[model samples]
Target chain A: MKKYSDRDSLLIFIVLIFFFILFIKLMYLQIILHVKIDRVVKKMVTKNNIENSKRGDILDIKGNILATSVKQYIIFLDSKIIKDLNKIKMILFKYGIKIKEQKITEFKEKSYIPIAYNVNIDIANKIRSQKLEGVGFDVRYTRHHPEGKFLTHILGITDCCGNGLEGIEKKYNKYLLGSKIVTRMYRDGYGHIIMQDKLVDQSKMCGQNVILSIDRNIQFIAEQELRKAFDKYNAKKAICIIQNPKNGGILAMVSLPDFDFSNRIKNLKILRNSAISDVYEPGSTFKIVTIAAALDMGKIKCSDSFYLENGKLKLGGHIIRDNHKINGTVSLSKIMEISSNIGIIKIAQKLVKKEFYDYIKKFGFHSLTGIDLIGESKGILMNLKYWNHLTLPTISFGQGIAVTPIQMLSAFSIIANDGVFKKPYVVQEIRKVNNKITFNILDNQKLGKRVVSYETAQIIKKLLRNVVESGTGKNAKVNGYSVAGKTGTAQKFDHKTKSYSTKFYTVSFCGMLPVINPKLVILVIIDEPKSNNYYAAAVAAPVFANIAKRTAEYLGIKKDKYEIV
Target chain B: MYKYFLLIILIILSIFIYLWQQNTSIRFAYKVSNLQTKYNKISIENDLLKLKINSLLALEKMYSIADRNGLMRPDGNNVVYLN
Candidate 1:
């Protein structure tokens, strides 16, 4: 080595020191702060994107779309990235979206400004094709009811976030809401996103579809006829329910004063399904229960005669009078034919109070019908211990008791179904998005309990048929079909006066088509009819006859009544 | 010397294969992404069409149309049984 002076040696030492310092800095960066830097870079390059699936549909029995979810877009703007505001405005205007001056001003301060909502895919696609910078779209689903006001009470409504809020939507929400999937994506240098895996099949992740037992045609027919009567009488409320007595499937149910669900609901009270939620004194409809019980329990026979105290009798410090006066004793069938209140009261006296109450429970009164619906009432039934002498007699005439329209329909169905009580249901099946049936009503069908003997049921059917043939239900006669049913006109009880209102009455008719082997059970109730005539025979019976005639023609039930040429 | 040379060639080939696979995977990812977007657009169009069909065929709408056209429901006596 060559010997150097002091200056040269100092230069060499400084150079070596500089190299050592550089090495230390490199080591510190690669080890000590490595994890922090790596984490920051990863967060910038990778994204967690949440993918939303569409909600399922609700269909009628014949696979008609009753309710569905359509994919809509929320057109938003990234204020930070948006430039050329006029150009964006021009592009949006081409798609018929007029952004107000105030809204355009709002776009500057907010990072994300939602310009429009519920934008159709076609319009959204047109705007997106313009390739305007700083414009983004957020996908959303909006519920749609295609049938307008038909089945409003059953289809229900949903919230803005696509959650079911009422009716069938609320009862089967979990099965109707689809899954939300989170996926990991990588961002390239050009800002293009690269998915880590193949895109998921959206239909597989979608919610299960619900199918109801309601027939749209039958519903339409019932709605049309019931609405005519409702408007004609200017009734406060009207309800109609048609059921298949064999399977307990509700074919059609309509409640009047229905609102269009597509519009904003101002009066939420109308949302209550009066057919299942609201209760009324069933009036003469409950008489069927008493007559069936008496016939079944051997307390009275079809041939047994009861004296109708000259159409009036004093009982429990109250006077019970019949609509028709019959002084002498008449057969059980004749008593029901004339709908004699004193006749039914005399018949009810034969059974013990405990026995009558037991029969009522067995008929599914004072208990939830176990219908797959929301807000079902078991009706107002006093317990055995609370029963006064008036309770038994009043309940016998359908006075002191209350029942929902569905309960009354079901009670009559017991007679039509050969005295077997089957639980009424609207939801027929639950199917996957792939059309694979996951739940069927038949699979979960409960074996009907026997409420009366088959013979007793046959006798009641004949008696009901006689009522429609030549008695109070004569107005309910259909041309080609044999109708077996009863008429009820119950006076409304005034709470303030503690007496029955002379002006207000609930007129109803519950009947079955084809007396023997009944296929359809229909019940119609017109509450507080404001028309000149409010009798069950005049108001409710005519409506029932019209519905039965049209429904029978549409269903093509063979004509049981033949006219001799 | 020959065995060492063969080992080096094998390592080089393995690295080439690995690089080829990575490139193909990225290309496939891009293709899949494009296809997914097309599928979403088509499905949206299909849903809209289905909704349109249902709305047009609604019973109330059909009834009104019939009424406007003066088409009445056939009476029971006029209809003959087919079966």
Candidate 2:
């Protein structure tokens, strides 16, 4: 009996040892695999929330903030923590938050609930004053354009992630979107905060700030004058550009029917930057190029004369007529003054089609101005081989081709800058957020290239000055400044009719101040003026005069001659 | 020996305090630099506001303002201009 009992006791001991080993194995697995398995589970269940960085500012030359980002708070609730639901509702009602009891009760089962979004500091302060449990706030940055609708198309706006959607904002998106900061947070088993990371100042991570060449006052004046002209004429659109003739710095550019940057533009057509994006037949404005080409090639002297056909000429199965039909043989100066199509056709007939076409190419037509704006159209220019006899004659009178407004302005700038063609630029400088001026020294200064011969440019300037003083552009004369410019009244082609429309015309004027040594070049275009007087001299030239006068006065440019109102 | 040890301890404490103050000043300088950027932005905004006000009061702008806002001359005789 004793031996049997001893054997049974030993079996019991063995079973007890087996059970102890199982418990020890479970403990080992829990200790060794706990962290790894838990990490995977947390990743699957908990979402990693990302905080978007605030967008950098668009500033004026003087560092005045044109656009900026301000901090706003999103009010949230963890309804599970609300000890008194009715009290919380009452408190929210006082702050104009409108939190319903039913919604709060429903949210009690959830971990978190969003009550209000995008509230400013004042509203946030009021909510915080209540000191209610379960109430929380998450911060976000909202963009504010301080200049209101000023320079709207240029400054542009951003999307939710701070991506520039258009204009300068779109042009320099990579430079303006600052680096985003990422952080991780974890909750304990009870959903209580176990770890938290501090917030980062997004401004520190922001990219370099851009300083535009635009002067705020000049922009204001241009917009004001262009708006007035647009309203007065009841035109479809108006465009004006003010540029520094020295280095191609576009000081001010306005394309009316311009959209306000802050408001959501309902008509997408208004967002189109007509100045650089739209191409038009330059009409008589292209005469500057024709004459310049003729002068450049030494084919005709400024005093040379040609017999103009009596009011009409047949070419390319098309009839060309002068708005003012002068019947006599006119000098080169007279042809320009009268804007005679026959006179230009007579001269253009002497040159080979390739020479004239090459000259057109040299004038920067059918090319992008590379003005640091996106979606620039390099206007349509037929290849030299594509030019027919008719093409040459028609192109001489500023037809059968298209050019952007910016290209035209750059061409004028070349004439104004003593024949040196400078590439137009909008951004003048870039500086870091700190007080250090990046362009403090000489080496950091910006520079440009020369485009034409100073002598040829001077000759062209003299002729253009005559056009303003005693010719077609006489209406564009400023009282004190010797204005040099050309007037254009081009028929806007109707695609459906496949011919120029009688009623639709683009009337334009391009002007340079102090003609002998020009400082500023201003261009104004009024589209489809309703009044019977749709001539460039009457509709567009006056707008140019007002902009030039106001801009000159604002810039403190001294008048070389006696002034008048 | 004990007095020498105490003196050594005092010197180390003084050195630590001096180093700590220097470190704090460097931090303060960094903060000041950050604040100055914000201040500069505000200063520019204030200047812009002042310019806007001045422009609104300028002769030409004021004339337009008066014309638009219905605050024109009480009578034709009340208007005056100096040549």
Candidate 3:
């Protein structure tokens, strides 16, 4: 053993004291203050990032893309992190982006500055690959409607945040809007970020898709033919709808004066789907309801006769006249064939006022058709208590009553569908992001109520056939198909005059082809045609004929009438 | 003495394995982050290409093209159907 001197002993004691102080400091940092220090480090190195999921698409029945979201980027700059500004400028310039010198100087003073918008994915990738410091990108999705001016009212438009604003887009917004995800990212000293966990599958987080019942080809045909007539007549507005009578699925619906949704809408009123929103007196078309009701209730027989008073009569101090003159007693079929106002009034008198109102409601009037659209009017139907002496008579001829074109078409569809009233719908199915169908129209089809007896429907079908064969709707006849329908020419009610206008008229025609087993129920309406001839027979019937002929040929329906070889 | 030496070696080996696992996990995280970014870029590119295809097949464009090419709709009398 060696003995230590006084100076060496002091040195050893001092070293031991220094080591005791170091141990105490390490204990404080590792135990008592560990939570606080760890929190500070995480705050500096970790960031919260919100990832937006892509919105779902809108497709037609044939799986054609009608509306979709395309990924776009907002190229931005963070002046604090940006190094080598000239290098970024040179690279962006190569991609046809010119940044001003003044803007660059101003950007340095601000932390975040958006440099470019709607930068496509390719250009964004190229800029990102350059690894220019301080350059950042914000992901955005833009809603694009590629079929311009086609199905404008149906496809609708979206806001800047990709929310649907109108039409089908508004009605099915929830299913079309996808969920957003939040993630935490860890950043290193070099500014590179690594996710804390595996990224969630983006498609699984996306919104479900909406599939419509509208066929693009049929829509094109209807739009083309109706546009020609609309331009020729210089009408205020025109609407056409073709529906499948069996299931009440709308094949095509066109409302003219349609604005391209991609462009800013100046007049929002045109955005209204006039097919189901605007109401007008259906004129002779309403006569079908009166006649069908009378026939169904056993108020009259097919062979029953009514006196026509030489095509004119007076009721409730108002004189009504028919366009064609007929004398003495005429058969029930002839009354509908010539659209005799007096004959229809006499037939309506068989039913009480309450009975007529009930039938009208049963035909889906005075209520929403329950269409999958946002803005639909239930139409103007006065309550039964509001009926005066003239109400029943005038409504019987479609003068006092008001209905939307869709309602009138649906009413006629009741006869075509063997008296069963089916609700009309445009959305056919809703599918998940995984292509699994979640909701299908066929799966949820409602067994429609029977509005009239099947026997009565068949008889009314025959009467409508006669109207197109040799009566007012003769212009609606196709060459090889037996047709059934009615023509309507209603005078516009003037608010200023407080009476019907003689100069302005709304002419319309509703018809079905192959009358035995009708495939398509079509309605064409021309409002305020600026022509000398504004009769429904002349204006609306011909348009209906062109659409029917072409549609029939396109659908390849077996010809009902065969010529002898 | 030999038992004590073996115990010390085992403790040292366990620490080494733990450190190696921690380092390897971080490296794998970085690789996975790169792959996720690549996948997102490709998905965006695919969406853009689909939109392009739809734009090309728009009905109005096709109609005008057909009209310019002197194509006419065939009349019912001129068409023959085969079963």
Q: What TM-score does candidate 2 reach?
A: 0.77
Measured against the true two-chain complex, the DockQ scores of the candidates, in the order shown, are 0.63, 0.05, 0.67
Tell me which of candidates 2 and 3 scores higher on DockQ: 3
Candidate 1 lDDT, A405-480, residue by residue in tens: 9999998899999999889999999999988988898876768889888998899889999999988999999998
Task: Order the candidates by TM-score, highest first.
Answer: 1, 3, 2
lDDT of 2 by residue, B1-83 (tens): 99999999999999999999987865664465457546634543453454455435444465567889888434222333342
Off by over 4 Å in 1: A1-27, A77-93, A100-115, A131-135, A563-565, B1-20
Candidate topping lDDT: 3
Docking quality band of candidate 3, CAPRI definitions: medium
- Model 2 alpha-carbon miss at residue A4, Å: 31
Stretches of model 3 off by over 4 angstroms after superposition: A1-19, A76-116, A129-136, A563-565, B1-13
Badly placed stretches (over 4 Å) of model 2 are A1-50, A75-118, A131-136, A183-202, A435-451, B1-83
Candidate 2 per-residue C-alpha lDDT over A63-173 given as tens digits, one digit per residue, 9 for 90 to 100: 666666665677888866867877877887777888866766776678578788657666777788878898888776666665566777777777765678888888877
Q: Model 2, residue A358: what's the lDDT?
A: 77
* Estimated TM-score for each candidate: 0.92, 0.77, 0.92
Please give the lDDT score at residue A424 for candidate 3.
Answer: 91
Instruction: Show how many residue pairs clash in every candidate, following the order shown.
Output: 0, 3, 0
